[model samples]
Target: MQIIKAVYINEMFKISKKKKICTSLIFLLLSVIVAAIVVYSLNNFAGVSVTGSSEFSVMVLTILSYSLFPLFTAFICIDMFAGEFADHTIKFTLTGPASRLNVFLGKILAIATFIASNLIVVAVLSFLFSLFLNGGISNPLRIIISYIMAFLPIFIFALTVVLISNFSRGTTSAFMFSIFVFLVFVGLSVAFPQIKSFLFTSSFDWYKLILGSYINVGKIFRIFLILLGYGLMLFAAGYYLFEKKDI
Candidate 1:
């Protein structure tokens, strides 16, 4: 436990020093600003009265989750795993007292932490912007729940990226492969609606299941179980590859 904690802190410190972290923040902020601008333009020029703060926040969340969130998650996972392996810097950590499993867990935890922080920032910024524009938010609790629930599917996506990174020999290859797999899954989900519920990609909008007025607990629980299964399997496979790889 202590070893994992130490490695988690060290990984976070390393991530903090990377320019990618700053770039992610800038991208998120720009996304919110762009969304706000679009809303403003639509209301003034197009004569569209978009006056729901909660709705605006949901719009931003949906866009980010489907686009930037997965891209950044892949970037971070590749850098942490594949990049380290390619650069041969992973040897330094492997030589330490901590076991490979501990190191892997720590890095995974760090990535999860950074992603959660990014989501929180996006939620806060979008909410504040919407509040300023629309005067007040309706159903703040639902918006909050939507953002919170988003983390689960995103984290599961991270696990998939981690597994991909383990199979990659370099950062570039890892990133390319991750994106290809992501697109493939998305395409598959669209091509075959029957199997959509089983795909992790379909769960990206899992939050919406709760957002609707109906609130089907059975469906939500089923999806949650699917995500949990994917996460566990991916984590185990990633760790197995990492353990066997020559660092």
Candidate 2:
């Protein structure tokens, strides 16, 4: 436990010392600004009638979370994992007393922490922006539920990126490969409708479970199982590959 904690802290400190976190936050702020403008314009100028703050926030959050979060998380994971290996700084960490397993799990935890924090920040900002644009929150509970459920896809993407990072030889390779996979999934999800439900990317919009008029428990559970299975598989594969690598 202590070893894992040390690795987590070290990873966090290393990331904090870099500009990636700052860059991510800046992007989040820009996204919020852009979303706010669009939402406000649609309501005020375009004469679209929205329910209230919750609906406005949900619209913005859906777009940002579904699109931006995956891309942002992939880059972050690539920098954290593949960048270390590419620069050979991973050797320094591996040389420590902590076992590879502990280090690997710790890194995963660190990535999750970073992503969760960023998502929470964006959710808050989105809600506040909605309040500023609209009068009040229409369905606070539903928006909150949406925020929590959205993290499911973010973590799934993180795991996939980590696997790509571990398998690839360099940061560029990791980033490119991960992005390629992302695009492929997004493309396939749209291009092929029949198998959409089977694709993990299809399940990324799990937030719809809350937004819809009817909540299907069975469908939600199935999506949850699919995501959970994929996450475990990706994490296990990445860990195995990382363990086998001559770090």
> For this target, which candidate reaches the highest TM-score against the unseen true structure?
1
Reference-based lDDT, residue 13, model 2: 90
Number of clashes found in candidate 1: 0
| Candidate 2 clash pair list | none
Cα distance off (Å), candidate 2, residue 90: 0.6
- The most accurate candidate by lDDT is 1
TM-score, candidate 2, is 0.94
Model 1 Cα RMSD, Å? 1.3
lDDT for model 1 comes to 0.90
Q: For model 2, what is the error of residue 109's alpha carbon versus the real structure, in angstroms, after optimal superposition?
A: 0.5
Off by over 4 Å in 2: 50-54
Overall lDDT per candidate, in order of appearance = 0.90, 0.83
Worst 10 residues of 1 by lDDT: 47-56
TM-score per prediction, in order, is 0.97, 0.94
